[model samples]
Target: MINLYEVQETNKMIEESNLDVRTITMGISLLDCCDTDVDKVCENIYNKITTQAKNLVSTGCEIENEFGIPIVNKRISVTPISLVGGSCCKTTDDYVKIAKALDRAALEVGVNFLGGYSALVSKGMTDSDRLLIESIPKALASTERVCSSVNVGSTKTGIDMDAVKLLGEKILETAELTKDADSLGCAKLVVFCNAPDDNPFMAGAFHGVTEGDAVINVGVSGPGVVKRALEKVRGEDFGTLCETIKKTAFKVTRVGQLVAQEASKRLNVPFGIIDLSLAPTPAVGDSVAEILEEIGLESVGAPGTTAALALLNDQVKKGGVMASSYVGGLSGAFIPVSEDQGMIDAVEANALTLEKLEAMTCVCSVGLDMIAIPGDTKATTISGIIADEMAIGMINQKTTAVRLIPVIGKDVGEMVEFGGLLGYAPVMPVNRFGCDAFVNRGGRIPAPIHSFKN
Candidate 1:
């Protein structure tokens, strides 16, 4: 284990490759903060979060300087607001008050984003869940750092088409509400099927009810490092390619483990899982698609792309599991269109389509992420797409999500700039064919047969 060569290689990865910790998310439970008075609920959670996460950003900076590794974002994840506002919160406006409080707390703590402006309606929508979903547009438009998610489907429970239909309308409204900012509000909204409890990455991270009071989750990133490793083994056999990726993921995850342990100890919080996801950014060479291209594909969306992604996703998991005892969340390859330079290029070149991306999500970690669509796209059609992706996750028993941003007043072939990290993307067109009838008939699609194995 004491090898100078391995240590030197790790250093090179940090120096040369765009290797870094994507986020150090502190999950804080807001259950105990719940109160019948909406204002009291807001005050309680805000005070709790501000007091608990006061040192989060500063600590992350200290760690980055000490270890000489970059920590891109420091975030907070609280309990799903639906649970906290269950009997206490009355109307959509009441929930919006809570959202503003979350935004204040995030700014106070100096964190980039604060997740858990969320509801879990996989089985059915409760009164609070309905109120929260209805208020998404206003809540998101009014806040700066708050992120929201709605779980409309899960493996144990069939897809909630009612929630899907409603969320489709909400998403379109959110875009319209933030049209001046390229519909940025929709960018912070995610619809998930079987959404994880401990995911550190957002637009979808919520500290589930089962989670403890507080904890630390680290999401690791190193797609550039994997792509670089593949360069040395160019034209190699499949075995060699897989092995190379495995070793690269191992090294990347090992660093995440170190960072997670340090953050947990410094904060006096329990160490949560290390999410070894190959999360790419807008930066060049730091792309999951580039790693696919290096695997002999001319372009990322070319034929056989799905097979290539399947291999890469599997190998990353294999290499990561051994490096960290607790590897959870969506610990696989991410293919966000706007966030990955290669993916954005492919979309612009007309090489990638909405249909192809949906097909690819079957094997990748997330579904239809950061794909900007024409503003005129019908709400029913968006719901239909969510229904399809939800079915995929429900049937396969995998965590799948949809974060389609329909830029208001924009059409296909137009570009919408969401600025840093979120990057920008050309609005891709969707099939206008009528899925109106299917999505309009709202009810739960029964859980798959395998889910009946009790």
Candidate 2:
């Protein structure tokens, strides 16, 4: 039932490649933590996170040591604060207070990031959603660890053009607000289509209504490992390549499940999901682009790259689903430009463009991530990007997102460094021909025919 040589080869790849788990995120639902009083609500939120997630870091570290595999980030995602505080918070300041509390809780628990300061305005925005989006800049600027997101579209609901327009303006405002902080606020915010509540990834993760009140969702990443596997099988047939990737993904996802179970047991939180996304880092050897290269592309964005990625993504899900009973979130291979060194290199070499990247997202995980564009790019163009990605997700019925940064004072081919995990990206050019009329239509793109199934 197994190939020892193949397993040994994959192990060698894991050792040589800079592969590691990207994050072990504990999803703590705060619905039960809600209250009519603002102070009481904040207290409940704080208590729930602190109590349920107290041992998250330690457990993650123990798993790392026990398995000899690095776990890069220990984090938490809670129910969208806007929804939890809807009945209690009357104004923007009330939401800000809750965000500050989340920041403090994250600091106290020793986690790097805490997500779910978010709202789902895909169909329409409520008063609470408006206040939450309005306060994102202030909340992000004031708090160090808190992250935010807004879901502007989904498969069944179609694109919320109004929400997309507002988020476009919010992106510019957020970038401007944190320009002095290297646009760090924008780094912490992600605008998503078909956003998942159980996602364990940063800047966009949140505990959705369907998830348990308190649970652990682990995100396993190892693009380097996958690349190395592909390298050893160079010149091999496509069937062999697919099998190799599937076997490797089984190993990676198994590690994730083990760590998630241990962390959940130690923290007294229910285990949620294993997101088997091959999330990359800025470091060498750990790159989704490298996997593409190993899969026969001279560089990412080359011809046939999409087909290779589609096979890779499908194989990963197949292996992960078999490895664990519970698998959710945006699980596949992430191709964030700045976050992956290979992707950054590809962009610099003129091998990749925004359009190509968008095309790739149709087959990959997490659409149009960490992309930097000229500051002068119109709001409508940015909205156009979101619209395009959302359309893909709606049509395909999968999770996709756009986290493009309109770096202020930055131009095409220029670089804006966010430093550290956020990494750096060259400002890619946008379409000169405006999408004004398309965006100005300002109405929902009706859900696809497929979504009408009873």
By lDDT, the best candidate is 1
What's the CA RMSD for each of the models? 0.8, 2.2
Residues 156-202, model 1: lDDT tens digits: 99999999999999999999999999999999999999999999999
Q: lDDT values of the candidates?
A: 0.94, 0.86
Regions of model 2 farther than 4 Å from truth: 1-14
Clashes in each model (backbone N, CA, C under 3 Å)? 0, 0
Evaluate model 2: give its TM-score: 0.95
Segments in model 1 whose C-alpha atoms lie over 4 Å from true places:
1-3
Give Cα distance to truth, residue 39, candidate 2, Å: 2.8
- Please tell me which predicted candidate would have the highest TM-score against the true structure: 1
> After best superposition, candidate 2 residue 190: deviation in angstroms?
1.3
**What pairs collide in candidate 1?**
none
lDDT of 2 by residue, 276-391 (tens): 99898898888888888888899988998889889989999988789999998999999999999999999999999888988888988889899888877788888888899999
